[model samples]
Target: MRRVLAALAAGAFLVTASACGSSGDSTGSDKASSSGGTTKVKVGVIPIVDVAPLYLGQEKGFFKKQGLELEVSLAQGGAAIVPAVASGQYQFGFSNSTSLMIAQSNNVPVKVVSNGIASTGVQGKDFGALTVKGDSSIKSADQVEGKKVAINTLKNINETAVRESVRKAGGDPDKVKFVELAFDQMPAALDSGQIDAAMVVEPALATVKSQGAREIASPLVDVAPDLTVAMYFTSTSYEQRNAAVVKRFQAAVAESLAYADAHPDEARQIVTTYTKIPAAVLAKVTLPAWPAEPDRASLDALQKLGQDDGLFKTAPDLDKLLP
Candidate 1:
């Protein structure tokens, strides 16, 4: 995971270094190719339950109705997608709010175009949680102190939320050893005792539970009620030059989110198209709130917690970043 971070950090540095050399042309006319009045655009996304709405949207003709055809490209995580979008490798991308904030703080020139996913705000029932082996002695977040707890990314949203959970549980978050492990690998790692605990979301969380893993804390919910965990974003360059396209995309995604939130069974069905999550496990997986719009108050709460955890070098400009 350290190697992945290092590679992504290098990619980000290259993106920052090349910002000044960009052509700054209108992407609507130059980048996005129109075929029979349909603008085809590529979107980088992580294949997770959080992104089910996008597939559902595509299937429901939400993007087609807007005259935009989406080409979904799967990536490992948001850390990789941010730079890819900033460099115009993709017209847009899905990412955790913290990662986008970090990129914006580092002058990566990204803009949030639409909300992605949010917590359910119910402890033990949210889409994401911090968990331990069912028979493990650790019963709460505080018990993770001096113990190895795995998070998908270091110094990102999950880490910040987990830290807050530990703090709220009356433990010193600094004392907990945080290891970087991908979400899919977490269940096996925890079962093998390779890690003391893991912070997981969606299908992975369901797999962990099937293994008799117990939820110790709902970290995302601990951050804030209905916390805006992730969002869809584009390069500021793309947004500025392709205003019409961006507007169309925003409307399409908003409809998609609303549709997914209302038709959860369809949302679950859509997950099979993009991810390998088992049918039984997928059925048990908790679906996150696909709010059509981001909750600003929730974002503010996340920003404060991120700042407290030193996740940002400079405070992200929410006014400029948000659509």
Candidate 2:
């Protein structure tokens, strides 16, 4: 399983490298509310390409059409986002399926309302890669055993996938030492030989590769075919009380996803508002697909993987969590 980057910490909302400016106010206060009335959803998201559809929704006014007032919040990561949504701190948010699976198992009362990014068999397009220092002796997952590895966080998406990949390569994942490091620190760590390898996503993945880190594996749709790398979510209570709102929100998001698919350059440009990556970085990084519907199989995979991997002690009724 690969390491999952879904944990939260105090300094979680690190400033995006390329945040151009705050998204101007998107509220349609003067217009009459839709069927369910004015609904405000504080959506938690990381400043990355995975959730590009969401940024498009905000930029293109899809939320407004749905009569939704979306306040996109900076989240630590997917791990902490479950609590934020489950407790109603965030009306909706984006997250990896792994944390949601474990949270559902723990009775967090959440559901994957919509799908975000699915693998399309495109390298650097729908998935990320793992890299080790080029000069280092480590070359494959099997060699990672008993070595120190750096991941964005423990028990998150990156960690989960790395463990699975390592095991698949005949390495005992438990034998590897894990360290939590930010994306920016990975190159330095590798340069200093402080960590044996790091599981990175673009543009960091590309950056490391350019620096001469040998490719170990690529985990995206290929690694976990049924796994949903990106997802949109809300609490069960919120969905129940605002069923119509949720549906409208879903429709808006679906539109945003379609638009992003058609206009990749514009999609990349919008992300510049929230991320630090330059246009050059976005150009090289591959963007994943924004599926119209949730991947039940992916959710199921995450649930089974979480339970089998002991990511959570109890498995929640995933059926109840789906909106």
Candidate 3:
């Protein structure tokens, strides 16, 4: 999260955010395809480790093999990129399921083409966590009642999972106060007692633990096991127009996932190019479960949580969301 962007900031109860290298606005060429033959498209993403496979694909020439040229743009979170993709400036995008489903319920034109990340739910493999200071009194989820918790975004995946974990831990989630903060800022906030706990994702979470933070819970695993964290998506209209091109792109990313899984060190090294993380810190950062393909079931699990929170007025059009 230090180098990752929590790009978009939603308002009020549904508020959540992440980092951004720069905003992804409609100021670039959208040329969905080229008459010269290669499929050219802009891809929007958050700087989190979840989207490492896409970068791996780029580095390993997976996209090139598919006759595709991908332009990777970093945003704070899914909210910023949804408009970009909907407007055709971004042919593909990466975002959390809740954000995507909410967008679709509002009739956004995007459709998920692949599952991006999943929760490992273990000490090392876990990508996100509910962390508290080493000496903090909050030792269990039940203790989180009436406590202040920091999240990358207010109502997004992390917060939703944290609240669920709290309930599972025998605490009343409605009694907990959720505050929005960049993942990187969370450690300091926790240390300073500005927040009683933090729901954080890797590299940032890893950094905090290194500074002697203790895990109160692994929200991703405890509340939503193997829950779909984020995804690779594109405008629905783009897929309808260039189905073949979309398939090729998905294949390339799938290959990248394999590459990342097989060569983690090399893959983590490549992350440096996109994230501003220091070399030493990058080496120690916790990476998430980057899946080779999208998982519909896990996505639905996440969607259920979001829908229960009133994120969607209708069930997500799952059939249409699949790649």
lDDT of each: 0.87, 0.69, 0.74
How many Å off is the CA of 316 in candidate 3? Answer: 1.6
> For residues 179-205, what per-residue lDDT tens digits would candidate 2 score against the true structure?
887665787788789998988765566
Candidate 3 TM-score versus the reference = 0.87
Ranking by lDDT: 1, 3, 2
TM of each candidate vs. truth:
0.91, 0.83, 0.87
How many clashes in each structure?
A: 0, 27, 15
Q: In candidate 1, what are the lDDT values of residues 163-233, reduced to their tens digit? A: 99999999999999999777888999999999999999988999999999999999999999999999999
Residue 241 of model 1 has an lDDT of: 88
Ranking by TM-score: 1, 3, 2
Query: What lDDT tens digits, residue by residue, belong to model 3 across residues 52-153?
Result: 778888878899989999877766566666666766767888887777777776666678887788777574358788899998977888798888888876
Best by lDDT: 1
- Model 1's TM-score against the true structure: 0.91
